[model samples]
Target: MSMFIRVKRKKTTYFLHCDPSETVLEIKQKLQALSENHVDDQRLILIANKLVLEDHKTLADQKVENDAIVAMTLKIRETGDWEEVVIDKPGEHPKPDTDAS
Candidate 1:
C-alpha cells in the first residue's frame, strides 16, 4: 500500500502518495522534478521527533506513516554561493544563527 505523506515547502504544502520501500533520496528526486530545485541541492529533513534523516534510509525505516508531514530545507547553489533556506511555518519567527556546528 502507498503511504500518504505531506511535504511542506515554504508556503506550499504538497501531498504525496509514496511507497514506504522507497529511499529518502528517491523522494527528494520526485521533489526535484516537481519544483525548481535540483535533487542534489535538496535536503529532506526528517521531522519525526526532530530527528535527522539520512538519504539512503527508506521511509518505512524512518517510521513515516500515512498522512505524515515532512519538513524540508533546501541548499541551493546560486551565483557562485550556496544558500540554505529554512521554510518556517506561518506566525513563527526564528532568529538567525550564524553558528555552524
Candidate 2:
C-alpha cells in the first residue's frame, strides 16, 4: 500500500504519497520543488515522536505508516546580503572639448 507523507516549512506545507521504503531526502526534495525553494547546505529534519530521522533513513526504516505527520524546521545559517556591481559603459571615455579650440 502507498503511504501519504506531510511536510511543513515556514508558512507552507505539502503532501505526497510514497512507498514505505521512500527516504526522507525524497520527501525533502519533493517539498522543495513544490514550494519553489532551494535547500541550503544544511538539511531539513524529519521527526516522528521526537526522533531525529537520519539521512540514509527511510520511512520504511522508521516503520512510518501511511498518512504520517512529519514536522519540518529550518536550520539557522549565517548569510550576508547580495552585492551589486555597477559596470561602466563599454569603451566609452570622456574626451576634452577640443573641437572648439
Please list the C-alpha lDDT of all candidates, in the order they appear. Answer: 0.76, 0.60
Which residue ranges in model 2 land beyond 4 Å of their true spot? 39-48, 79-101
lDDT of 1 by residue, 1-101 (tens): 89888888678777888999989888888888788677777666656665556789998998888888787776644654334445668778777888999
List where candidate 1 sits over 4 angstroms from the true fold. 76-101
| Whole-structure CA lDDT of model 1 | 0.76
Task: Score residue 34 of candidate 2 by CA lDDT.
Answer: 73
Choose the strongest candidate by lDDT: 1
Q: Pick the TM-score winner.
A: 1
TM-score of candidate 2 against the unseen true structure: 0.61
